[model samples]
Target: MKDYVIGLYEKAMPNTLTWREKLECARFFKYDFLEMSIDETDEKLKRLDMTKEERKALVDLMFEVGVPIRTMCLSGHRKFPLGSEDKTTRERSLKIMEKAIDLACDLGIRIIQLAGYDVYYENGNEKTREFFLENLKKSVDLASKKGIILAFETMETNFMNTVGKAMEYVKKIDSPYLGVYPDCGNITNASKSLGEDVIFDLKKGHGKIFALHLKETVRGKFREIPFGTGHVDFNEIIKTSYEMGVRRFVTEFWYTGEGDYKEGIKFSKDFIDRKFEEALKDK
Candidate 1:
């Protein structure tokens, strides 16, 4: 297996940090890149509204800091799910996705990690699933035209909670731009929710698993916490995924603004490095 380049998620930086601070943290942590996010907030949504010049300036700053934004996590689905029943809301969701895709192209982002929610904070049914797939097809088409990859992240939801399920869509879409971004922590949570041992079929994706969101999750409680404090079997995940040809990982967690974040960064990076090697050497 090839070596992996680990990235810090956008939430790794506290909201108080300026762009410079965030980039500095990435550089200081010696990360290969940083993951940008477009979630359900006026502040985060501003990235979609930035002028082309402004976007260029931000990208330039990242280049100066040597911390490229390689991927985008479009978490705005929690607010505007594609499977929303309301026609207006579903249309808005698609618009947000289109705008995010445009911004991603401007920023040189290679992948857009989409949330797995067909409908968030709302009931889902056959019609909702149909709407979700319909909107996703549109997004995939636009992404293909723009030369961008849209990988669906395994979520803490009843829909698309595993890589296997995501593969169903990948096959249906039949586009290289569409794939899976499985989160190990979310898998653990989903397993607990189902009262069964649900493990990710990393190899089943046939290397279409574009990225992995590495995080810790205490089942039935939280998905983001300190490393090794959850049920996630990092050893198994890394070993299985690496053998399946996964060579990219994103350490997803929110900055707590507690002690120096450098400690957390160092911990995360080193842990990933060590576990990656450990998994490779196992058996």
Candidate 2:
């Protein structure tokens, strides 16, 4: 058995495929699991309202395909941010949180990676920040009861771009259910932009880090950068995170309608596997 788990992000494949097809593709690429995406799109958001039979069918499909979705990237809050100034939006955000937790429970997903943002579209002031904290505490309480982990994803925004920044909320929430799930690419960009070291930033969330997103990024760009074409140092980042006790990783990228999308998936897995091998060889 492998010492750690590696998963593919759902967006890494074409959304046109069904869940069975996606799971087959992930298994074909030798990924240990798949990280389900619940983004800001209405289509993705509708997944939370899935009926019991639909959820059961998905669970059965995982068993049939032999690859399970072990984590969720819940970015739906990016649209209805928890710290919105409008009461209606804030209420919607909390509703999203509750439904996400329920979906995670039904799907047997262990961790839900939350987008770390107080307010994405609007201006973030002290009031918004306070509202964020208040809602965050309530979210954690819901997660704690269900025994699901709700981890912060270090986002590209200035609001919560670093693991250190994410830890502030984790510490404030003070629950085992809340932790950090840093995106290597985003943190790499944040550190370089601020003249800081990525490893140092990761160390700030040492024990609180539940997972890592093994993505590729260059200066100023946050998404869709092909692996190995970017400036991210996957080796050192993986090494630091591994030593810090992170055993789960998900390759985060998009499938931009490439004809050889399978080839792209294979290349990403191989590249990240090499980094993991190098990082954990001596440990």
Candidate 3:
């Protein structure tokens, strides 16, 4: 039997929870893994500084609860995107990537999802694209050395808003450890921006897709919307992607404590599972 590793993104949990509590939440929700977040908050960012012993203890709890944090979403790039034309910013982001690899090694995480934008805070150009590729090469080199994979996410940017653009860097880097972590919702939004219709075929990136961010997004909206409330064509996207090569998936969403969290988790789990089943049936 084939296994589909469905994980819950860290956004599903309250940031206030201790690592152990977070693991427990994953176990309670029947998820196979937890996609850890290393976002912009000072508290979240501090995880990069975790000591070896602390990391081991956390890993121990992961084993205890049967919820491994197998993937990481590296969101710090919002502050220090690697593709920036500024040398200082690019250097700082490169250092952050190095530290992130070390942290991943300690925690037994396998893949780090890289943000697509080389410089999200600024506009893009050929120079910025060159800088991003250069900096991404450095990151890929480090990740290869550390025995971890770095999958780039297609984001809301002109540079790499689709899997095809992400493939540009993946092909340039051409490392076994470098792959694409596509966000189908973001792809829809990008298609709208370009006045195109699904320019990126997930199958085109087959063998290079490490995983997926299964978030819902309407054409005009991007983040924090309820699941299935957006224009994300879950049935088609899931079917096509599963038929390609992706078996790992993380449902990307933010928890604002507006409604019942447990109920919502169960609902999403069921919905995704149903979609996966439908995808398999179509095969």
Candidate 4:
């Protein structure tokens, strides 16, 4: 059977709580791993309020609770373009990524997903593409030194928004540590762009996928609906991923609403378990 891991995004917790309370909630949720977002204001290692020893103690507490960090989702390109000609933002993005890579190394995580260049349209010049590849090579080199995989994720508005384009970019990188984190919902959106079936895109892109983000999006915006409530076919995704030899998955459902977070996680766990069992039965 495949190993399914539950994780909590930083946005899932109440913002008013302290860092200790957030970590405690992750333990209470019984998650096998935790995922954190890396942005300008959310650097995990640069918390001014927590001393070095206190952060180490928190890390120890997480290990004691049997939960390890899986990845740091770097949100560098949401505001600053990694492929931009702007020197200041580009350098700042790389510095932030380097810091995140170091922190992930300290925490023993092997993967860091880069939310790639945030291009508004598909019309990317050769210079822009070259810049992207060069910057990524730099990031990949830094990550490789730390024994970490720098996985790049697709975005709605970018050069590599589709699975085919994402594959092309990764193939150019040609590093074992360089791959794609195939977001199911993103695939669904990109299908419309090509006027093709979503599952077809997923199958074609499965070989290069390093990790899977289980997302259930409704309409254009990602509302984090329950597993079966959205158009993302969980069964097909899981079956295809297993066929591709992908085992680790991160369940992400972030929304501001009336539902209880714990209950949502429980439902997600049960839903994934059933999907895996069904896949095995078919096999």
Whole-model lDDT per candidate: 0.85, 0.94, 0.85, 0.69
Task: Show model 3 residue runs off by greater than 4 Å.
Answer: 195-200
Per residue, candidate 4 scores C-alpha lDDT tens digits across 47-137 of 4234567658767876776676677777656555567676886786677767777777776777787775633323467776777788888
Query: Which residue pairs collide, candidate 1?
Result: none
lDDT of 3 by residue, 160-227 (tens): 88988898889999999999999888988987777766535566688899899998888778788777
Ranking by TM-score: 2, 3, 1, 4
Per-model C-alpha RMSD = 2.0, 0.8, 1.6, 3.0
TM-score of 4: 0.86
lDDT of 3: 0.85
Clashes of each: 0, 0, 1, 0
Q: Among all windows of ten consecutive residues in candidate 1, which has the lowest summed lDDT?
A: 195-204
Worst 10 residues of 4 by lDDT: 42-51
Residue 263 in candidate 4, Cα distance off native in Å: 3.0
Which prediction has more favorable lDDT, 1 or 2? 2
Q: lDDT tens string, model 1, 133-155?
A: 99999999999889999998988
Lowest summed lDDT window (length 10), candidate 3: 195-204
What is the TM-score of candidate 1?
A: 0.94
